[model samples]
Target chain A: MSQPEILNQAFELGYTYTRSTGPVVGRFLTGLKNRKLVGIKASDGRVIVPPMEYDPDTAEELSEFVDVGEQGEIVTFAWVKEPREAHPMNEPFAWAMIKLDGADVPMIHCVAAKSESDVTTGARVRAVWADETIGFMTDIRCFELV
Target chain B: MSEEEQEMITKVEAPVYLKYNFTAGSAPTRFLAQIKKGVLAGQRCPKCLAVYIPTRGSCGRCGVPTVEEVELSDKATVQSFTIVSIPIPNNPIEPPFIIANVVPDGANVSFIHLMSECVNEEVHIGQRVQAVWKPEDEWGYSMDNIRYFKPLDEPDVPIELIGKLTVTGEEG
Candidate 1:
């Protein structure tokens, strides 16, 4: 069979996977549950949003946590005409990497705007939390253009 | 970094589970069905003389399609084996079982299966054995058919007499 045929057949059979994120990510999830956007500042002073467990540059374990502002500035974005499975939005939306105020790096999230024209770089947005959350990244549905 | 900043961190619980669909291939489907019938089946490469257990549609070595169906003899000789103490994910069998590569009489290649009905010390290279199949009701088209391979009371054949069958060398 062709590669695509093989892939299609494989998809029909069910598979499940469970991942265990280390301590750093676990702490970050707790902060999100309390409606806080936390960042981990590296030794070099770069503050990473969605605090990573390991410093990307040095590979050292991160322990410091700082609360960041819920609002952020969109650095770059893509008009997602075709939303993929489990995306915050089911309809056409914009996915942007926004640098939360006081955080040095950007965090990827959906921009809940009616149209592409409604979003652009430097636009202010705020975290839109779900009515109910189970501590996963989906807790924050998307960011609404402020 | 300040000592006060490090002291503010605490552990938290983060549970993540992902689910997706996985489909079986045609060759594996047939293999599973045969296991349900308490039968062990292998796909024979007519051109290469290689018999693939839990049969493969294509030969890895010769790059040819294995079309000929062969009912491999239940009896085989252990070539090499490993004792699996750790659990393998999604496997139905329990841990501490012996998995071995057994070369059936007249087949050039070895097939992997559980080695049972014998003590760990009793398992050795070149020992003659036969498959102990599970009940028909317990069968599935998987290697689970022959529950395990047991030691044969009879004598083993001479190693020299067991010739390596090669497709490139001669016609079958």
Candidate 2:
């Protein structure tokens, strides 16, 4: 095939993924709907953020629900030079796993900063909200560096 | 259960539909486009002679780019098959359908396509089959171009001869 002809044949394939989150994730979303940041406390008393349905260390279902502070400290993050499809932002942004106050594990989300250099480990950030809110993760627009 | 009660509970009309936008990635787009024209195309790795259905831009084994475009035969053999009694959500086909791994006559890879014109018990490994194109009106650049594969009258081709054609990447 000719170059242009072959190039023309190349097109994008689309797919829709419908994931069924188990009870723990379902309960977490329900809590988020009430504007509550819920965590599942592990057996050792480490309250994990964005409550893990299954404990990574124990491989058991987490049952305890602990309310964590909405505010948190930036644990670590990578500068997303080019955000992939379905990411919170289309433009340049920073994705960080923030360990919320009173929570042990970090949660992944975008951090809003003027530039990558502006974001740093241990930076204090707070959740920003959209004008309208759904119970989904996108409800928190991004963390603004304090 | 009383017949009258059963009849009363059975509602005649049920409407179920799912709406979502699908984006085709790079490799599948080429495969779909060829389906629209009723042509069989496979990706040929220049270095290893591996031909892939649902052609890939690069060779998985050699990790080099495959530049050759090889037109393959529609005739293929059924390596294995399953009667799908449980339907996967969002798929175009309904349940109780036959899906088979069809290894085309001159390619290393086997593609999963619907099997038609045979009883469930009639389907077996090494069964000869040929592509049955959908009506011209319904043709598009997708695997849907060939509606399904049906039993072919040609004698069974040997595994050694079939193996000669470069096996493309693994089954999808």
Candidate 3:
């Protein structure tokens, strides 16, 4: 008797998991949903954008929330000539460590620019909110040169 | 963060989807070869003497690699089972099916598999069963090669041999 053909099947794997974002992160995501920018004061009174629950160096608790401006300066950036699959944008963009107005510390985010020549270490940029905000880090779709 | 904002922070619901293909490790690679030839291979732990089906690289109890390979008999006993009536998504079988932990002959530990060729109500501890394989060509490098364990129409496995299959059960 002839042998039976090999069996092969592809399956879809999915899971739905809900978790608490905690007070600090929840407040920041809520701010993004409302098209507002917010940061938290670190242990030593240094404003840390994209708030950390505890100060990294001192390990002190952080809770004081401060409203920050949407516009910020690109303290430093890396130009992506060829974007990878996980990159925010398909076209060439720069991943910048931005220091938003009124915040002492810089936060890493992607900045949209025409080319490497258009992006600079001290270039000013502003947050571009998504069309429909759902309280996610991706809510700030991407930053654009101001 | 203010008290009002803390109160407003509710549970965040997010559904994750991912796809991955894993390479079969060395032990699994050899076990797959045996399954392709319609055989169930097991590795025995030198220290604990536990027979691990689909041969594991190391013995959990001994913490040593099993160098000897042994072929296990197709016949096994339904040492334990559960009648799953809940309709869970991604469940291979329909509701009200029996998923059993059957100890193949001469193997110390039991292997979990679906029990076929017997009514859900008839499946019980010590019920003798036999591995029913798919067509030879349909065989693959997975436990799927054995479609299911079916009734053997024989007496229950020996009481002494059945031993303490369950950890919570008294020593046999």
Candidate 4:
């Protein structure tokens, strides 16, 4: 007839650390700070956005950097109907695999849209830069449907 | 662009934070209900007949369901313990406190709890201890109902007979 008292508590797990991003990743982050997009040349000559330090197939050290376009097409996406507190977007959004212009490989990022119907495969989207561009992935706030 | 803006970034500080709301399960809820009344309770496995305080709803050794309820004694014996010198992150308690793994009479399993009101260096295996509970008004569905354990005046149980005691506090 009466509800039993249940035990509950809020818990927080944290980790704080500093690390060196080395030349390749550091260069890509630096490009974002400068309001530019950078990609690396793969062994097969395909350009990879969010550049890799080495070619995955040949395992060769990659040094060539190519400037890629800010606009891209969504390859696929998962729509978040109910956003959680940890999500980048408070409102409903989509985490999409985007193929930027001039880059063969697609990068995963969040996209802001009015509704799930607004997002589709091959939908064109452009990067929305933050007011202050720091050398971090958050420099590009989120992509918007173009 | 400024020269500093053109300079390459090398290092980054990444701090991660996670939050969650934890809820107690059925077995613990039953145990905490009794704990709110200043009692310790456990579940006994049907297959192994081993009692566990704050029961896991199943026997760890026998893999059988521990459905039979058994009330345990607040008096316990220190099976093992550690005197910490380094402070834990975000915890209010300072260093140099004793944390012990204590097996209560009638329970085959041991649980961790703070040990206080005794010389840290003097705390040893098979030491007899009793729960030092907080005020009745402050009691809730939490292990914190007992502030800490203190040394009891009773003689220490032998090291080999630590968890092998009956409900009446006799050798099992």
Give the best candidate by DockQ. 4
Task: Order the candidates by lDDT, highest first.
Answer: 4, 3, 2, 1
RMSD of each: 6.5, 10.5, 6.5, 4.0
Please write out the lDDT profile of model 1 over residues B1-172, one tens digit for every residue: 2553353334334334465565657776665655566655678777777777767677888989887766656777787889888887667878788999987654567888898878887777767788887776766545667778998886554554332423221212
Better of 1 and 2 by TM-score: 1
lDDT of 3 by residue, A3-112 (tens): 33443445558786788888788888888877788899987778998988898788978889999999999999999999987679999999999999999999999999
Worst 10 residues of 2 chain A by lDDT: A3-12
TM-score for every candidate vs. truth? 0.67, 0.55, 0.67, 0.77
On residues B109-151, what C-alpha lDDT tens digit does candidate 4 reach at each position?
8899999999999999999898899999999888999999999
* C-alpha lDDT score of every prediction, in listed order: 0.74, 0.75, 0.81, 0.91
Per-residue lDDT value at A16 in model 4: 63
The ten-residue window of minimal lDDT in model 1 chain B covers: B163-172
Instruction: Assess the local accuracy of residue A55 in candidate 2 as a C-alpha lDDT between 0 and 100.
Output: 76
- If you score just chain A, what TM-score does every candidate get? 0.87, 0.84, 0.86, 0.92
lDDT of 2 by residue, B1-172 (tens): 2542232211112233344455555666666677677878888888987888878778999998876777778888887799999867567777788999998866777889999888877887778888999888889767878889999886665655543433232132
DockQ of each: 0.21, 0.03, 0.33, 0.58
Q: After superposition, how far is residue A73 of candidate 3 from its true place, in Å?
A: 1.2
TM-score value, chain A, candidate 3 = 0.86
Where does candidate 2 stray beyond 4 Å?
Answer: A1-25, A42-46, A52-63, A75-77, A104-106, A116-123, A130-135, B1-79, B101-112, B117-130, B134-145, B151-172
lDDT of 2: 0.75
For every model shown, the clashing-pair count is: 12, 10, 0, 0
